[model samples]
Target: MKLALGPLLYYWEKQTVETFYQQALTSEADIIYLGETVCSKRRELKTRDWINLAKQLADAKKEVVLSSMALLEAPSEIKILRQICENGLFKVEANDLGAVQILAENKVPFVCGPAINCYNASVIKLLINKGMQRWVMPVELSRDWLIKILAECTQLGIREQFEVELFAHGHIPLAYSARCFTARSENKAKDDCKLCCIKYPVGRPATTQEDQQVFVLNGIQTQSGYCYNLLNDVPSMQGLVDIIRVSPSGTESFTSLQDYRAAVNGTGSPIQLASKECNGFWHKIAGFQTQQ
Candidate 1:
């Protein structure tokens, strides 16, 4: 299966973003997703910069996709989405209905991001009719759920028309809100928060009273505290998955990508980075629990 690097969910400085992608160009990731999928207020790199970056990656023989914001609250954000959809170069990943509508209206084929809540074959069929080229399975769905969906698609005779991309690695983006939890955590309002999320490049951890991590707070996004890993499960996904996505995390993200690529090629074993890892959602259990 091909490897894809998911968009950066946490806010980072312009230099950091650029440096990350520069190194990513040489990484084992076959597909790289650009643009901000979190708060639009994090404008370290503007629309033009993301398009240019996408162009750079596309020129490197890597499949590039521009990802849209999951929570769009302002008109300016919609305008940015329109610019990405109308770029006429790389394909766009629709995270919200606005993006889907925009891409559909423009007669452009788009990939459905994990945030789009595509639960069954019927929804997949509707999106396919609207020009969806691929579907990134939602982070909460299990292997059996995907089998059922694919089985249903086969019954409907549309299974071969699209590809399946799974969010295989990284912290799961659980939810997005109008309220910026990072700013709120700093006791500041979302508007005048002074870009507090930049302080936590890896995101702030929300721990339970027992000192156990429960969630990760990154700007407007709420992510799972444990990193979601499927390196060991790569063998089982041979025919079922077309692409495996690895989300950017800490400084070891490139190493994680190497590990995933090696595992996919059957040359090396999966590397354990974070102290905690979760494959529970894929096994149909509590999202934080790891399953063998």
Candidate 2:
């Protein structure tokens, strides 16, 4: 299976983001997704910069994809989305329906990102007809769900039309909202709030009353508190998935990529799950619970 590095969900400074991708050049990642998929206000790198970065990674013999924002609330966001879709160089991952519409209208072959609520084979078929090149299964879906969907696709003879990507690692992106949760947590309004998300590299952990981490607040995106790991489940993904995606989480991103590479290559034994990691969604349980 191919290894893909998902877009950076957290906000970081320009240099930090640049440095991360620089290190990614030599990492085990076969595919690297660029662009900011969270809040557009986190403009440490603009559209031109992302396209430039994608070019650099593409030139390095790595398949590069430009990811779009999950929640777009302004015309300016649409304008930027158009620019990404029209970049004409790298594939674009459509995180929202608006992006899907734009890419479809332009007849561009695009990736249906995890944020898109594509739950059935029918949607997959429709997207394929609209020029979807790949489908990144929603993070919350289970293995059984995927098997059923792929079966349906096979029955319909559309299974071979597109590749299936699974969000195999990193924190699960649970939801996106119009409100900036990070700004609100800092007692600031969404508009006037300073760029506070950058202070917490991986996002501010939201804990339950019992002092258990339940969610991570990153700008407008809400992610699962525990990292979603599938290193032990690589064998299960053999024929079912074409690519395994690892979301960027900070300094450990490259190490996690290497670990996944080893697991995929059979160069390492099954790694034990950490206390902060879970693979419940893949096992059809509560998303934050690790299946033993």
Q: Highest lDDT, which number?
A: 2
lDDT tens per residue, model 1, 219-276: 8889999989988888888889999999998558888788878888899765554568
lDDT tens string, model 2, 1-292?
8999999998999999999999888888999999989988989999999988888888889999999999899999999999999888889999999988988899999999999999999999999988999999999999999999999999999999999999999888999999999999999999987999989999999998999999999999999999999999998898899999999987688888888888888897876799999999999999999975
Residue 167 lDDT in model 1? 97
Runs of candidate 1 with Cα error greater than 4 angstroms are 270-274
TM-score of 2: 0.98
Sequence-dependent TM-score of model 1 = 0.97
| lDDT for predicted candidate 2 compared with the true structure | 0.92
lDDT of 2 at 144: 95
Candidate 1 yields a Cα-based lDDT of: 0.91
User: How much lDDT does each candidate structure score?
Assistant: 0.91, 0.92
Looking at candidate 2, the ten consecutive residues that score lowest on lDDT are: 263-272
